[model samples]
Target chain A: MGKLISMEGNQAAAEAMRQINPDVVAAYPITPQTEVVQTFAQFVADGRVDTEFITVESEHSAMSACVGAAAAGTRVMTATSANGMALMWEILYIAASTRLPIVMALVNRALSANINIHCDHSDSMGARDAGWIQLYCENSQEVYDTLIQAVRIAEHPQVRLPVMVCYDGFIISHAVECLKLLEDKEVQEFVGEFKPVNSLLDIAHPHTFGPLDLYDFYFEHKRQQIEAYGPAKQVIVEIGKQFSALSGREYGLFEGYRLQDARLAIVLLGSAAGTAKEAVDRLRADGLPIGLLKLRAFRPFPSEELIQLLGGFEAVAVLDRAVSFGATAGPLFTEISSALFRADRRPLLVNYIYGLGGRDIDIEDIQKVGEELERTAERGKTEQLVDYVSVRE
Target chain B: MRQVLLAADTPVVVANATGCLEVATTIFPYTAWRCPFIHCAFENAASTLSGVETAYRALKKKGKISQDIRFIAFGGDGGTYDIGLQALSGACERGHRMLYVCYDNQAYMNTGIQRSSATPLGAATTTCPAGKLLPGKSQNRKDLTEIMAAHHIPYVAQTSPGRWNDLVSKTQTALRTEGPSFMNVLSPCPRGWRFPPNETIKIAQLAVDTCLWPLYEVVEGKWRLTYRPKQKLPVEEWLKTQGRFAHLFKGDNQQVIEQLQAEVDRRWEELLEKSS
Candidate 1:
């Protein structure tokens, strides 16, 4: 196996960056995500990485610079949080539409009108349709491991798309955890060399990026990008397998924790998945059939896999840390419900919106959800389609 | 731009902001750029090119790039003087060896004549029109040349396409400078300025001769006048040529014209003082 060590999510991300040693990194700081770039900047200064780290003034420029560097035919990476990601919304589409395989560590934080800095899924969920591969990590280990795999998944020729390696901000970001670290040479060999088909610096064989396409050809280019996502789903699975082999960690698009024969379960993303797993074990030990499916590949939503895995379960609760605002259910709940629409044995789905701006969902809270799912199963339908947890309602 | 296009002795990677230059040349599958060009976003040409230039330096230092490739960026006055100012400032402050050229058309011409920070005092634009209450843009055009020079970069200049030789020579010096360089070139937009297409060069010349747009350069920290008018004409000569300023000659706008003239004369005197 690789070397075992303890590090926080930000440093784990920095460690992954140090190992990857990309050609360029352009980043701006926001709360919760600041430590990722700061730690990486330290690596760049100490001469541990050969990356050209551009300390851009704003998140807009950060993504812009990443686009420029990635177009220049180099491996470029960056990081940002909620409002920072919101600032980068315009270029995020440009970067993905231009098909620049840039990787970023997105420390999820709540987007603001009240201006708070804490964990939430609203940030990346808002950009769900912006044509980027989104990977949600459960902890610091997953953060490091997923980031290394992200470069491979992004740069995959069939999937020349940007990837957002997202982990919970401040919670996983600042909390230290025991994880296996890969050797630098191992990561180098796995990622391989990024040989761009058309580089901006390739003077003889010139290419143009971000051209204005109106009416005639914009649809076709966008359609081609759409066609790639189907193939990208396969690439995510294949890369996960390869990563698992190298690190002795089994991985898939989503993890099934004691999900083999469970009749009631909760599906979710990020750090809450780990908490739900504990809730699953506690309920199972009490002789109740309950389990958890922690979603990892959110962009390529794994609808087909969900059909096979969660379709047979009698009832399932989707715990969302973000509200979709005006939608019938939470963002994660909507996706899960939509995925099971065509299943032969669809589960009775319920939504529990919790933990906005990082309001700590615990094991008991999740077990309570499991008990509610059992009740929903006994009732043969969801009495309440969506409910709020831990918030004063 | 034409002069620099002709004068370039080496291959250049061009970065352009969203403007007439970018939109006009690149139309999906067909591109007019013979060299590598990138246009990321409207307000980030400087930072975007900063990324490309940074990549080039990193690659060259690591011995991946052997060819001598130069970096160049082009942005409209709107991109350089307004929305893109911070990125431009940051790029210059970081000291990358790239030539950043602002095609100073003085307004958002591609979007059909909206007022930009580079739009001068008393120039009519769609956003700031010369109407009953307002007499065109009241604020002076931002002194972007001086603002850029404040970054203490290796080269900063104000030139016009009207003087082809001076424009070409200034471009050569800016490109050859070992650190960041900036050039603000007066680009006469006939459609936006409401002037005849053939009079583009003549209007640019008038701008220089009237002391409204001076031809000057700052090399390192020292200033030098590249061209000086032998007999400075009244600013009215520059304003009256364009229909955008047609309202100024009409009722009650002569005082506004005088204000424009006084401001131009003050800036010109300051330039002369600095150069000497």
Candidate 2:
């Protein structure tokens, strides 16, 4: 059994980083994500890890440095949130398309306009199409476990794509929780040594990365990258199973809580799922057949499996913390509706764009969503296809 | 350009910015690079190579890497003098063991002769056209080599491709430097400057003779002039050779020409003071 310790999400992430002890970590401090790099810096200073910690000027250079290091065939990592991630937008695509297999810890936060530094999914949600495998964690323990597994997923021979391990900004990042910690030896053994394919340092075989791809071959290269996701999904499942054996905690593409034969269900991501689970339990006591589907992996989106799971539900509500502007609904809502469009038996789906700019979504707000799902199930239709929860009318 | 790497005893890894060299060399199915090359994005060649150098250090310490390797990054003026300055400055401040080379063409030649900060004051670019209303680019060029020298890195040099011996020697010195080093090479563009393809080397040589682009190197914060023309030529000798500055010689534009010469003389005096 692993040792149990009390730590915050950022601390747990730093501890995981220390255990892995990657070759390079280039990062700049951003709100809610600062503690992770700060603690890692401490680890480097104290000689606990042999990491070349680069105190970069901006988030743009941080990601650029990681790309350079990763292409040179080393395990590289960084952390950022909100506008910091926004600053890394251009390099993010370069890192992914180059197949660098870099791992990043992304603390989800609201983007600017009102200049707030609170929890929201707008950051990572905006980067969904950048071709990174994204994993959302609910609590500190999941944060620890997912980061360790992310290294394996990203560096896998079949995957070899960058991974973003995300958690709610202040909700999970600053909140303390009791979690099990793995030993340094076990983690080192699990992560093993990274063997770079066509590393820039390889003197025998020279390779060029991120070449100019015009009309003749850009489409084919992108198609190959898209197909890599197929193998990545399988690798994620296998790595999850391996991680469960080590930690004795089960993980999958998505977790279904009290979902067997659930008539009314709500699907969401990140820490809000924990609150929705509490609302599910309270409503289950009132004899309502309701449950929650908390997504763990957002990229390589488990679309077919989600379609099968929601097919049996009488009514399902997709809760998103980020808005998609003029789209039919939020990001997750659009994907869910599209997935179910081809299903033989589809549920009455509704979207609730809640918790913008870190607005509170308490158990009460989620319970109301449960009740609305139940009502839609009874009526066999939704009064409104898109709505907002915990918002002023 | 590849000869510099070929001259080295160790393996070379190149990180190039997105510009003419990157696009024209590496097509999808074919690549002209004989060694490892990476093009991360525009404006990040220095930062990317910093990462590569950092990885080299880490792996060498871990005994995973045994062979000696050198890292070099290449960027045009747009990537080096403008958008890429922050990344380059950070890499230099951190003292990464790499060499950054800026092929200074003075304009965004790959983007159809657009005006860049490196474009000379009276040079006519597409964006800063020398029309009847405006003579040419109103602002003076940025002094990037001096800016890099301020970083106090191991080596910093300003050379032109016209002087093959000076350019080759400076490149060797930059490659041999232990810490961060920078080189600014004057690369004339035929299409952008509206000069004959055969006159590229001649224009670069004229730039050196006119004191417009002096050849100098700063080693360990001490400046040294690499080449001093026997007798400095008039600025008009260099200006008349390129069509970009031809308008400055026309009616009413003579003042612009005078202003260009004054700025160049002032910069040359300052450089001489530092070198002495």
Share of real interface contacts recovered by each model?
0.83, 0.84
Q: State residue B61's C-alpha deviation in candidate 2, in Å.
A: 0.5
Q: Lowest-lDDT window of 10 residues in candidate 2 chain A? A: A195-204
Instruction: Kindly report which residue stretches of model 2 are placed more than 4 angstroms away from their true locations once superposed.
Output: none
Q: Candidate 1: lDDT over CA atoms?
A: 0.92
Error of 2 at A392 (Å): 1.7
What lDDT does the true structure give each of the candidates?
Answer: 0.92, 0.93
For residues A1-393, could you state the per-residue lDDT of candidate 1 as single tens digits?
578898899999989999999999999989898888999999998999999899998999899989989999899999999999999999999999999999999999999977889999899999999999999999999999999999999999999999999999988999989998988999999999998868999999989888999999999998999998998999998998998889888777999999888898888999998888888999999888988899999998899989989888899999998888899999888998998998999899999999999889999999899988899999998899999889996
C-alpha TM-score for every candidate: 0.99, 0.99
Name the docking class for model 2.
high
Docking class of 1: high
Candidates' RMSD to native: 1.0, 1.0
Model 1 regions more than 4 Å off: none
Clash pairs (backbone) in predicted model 2: none
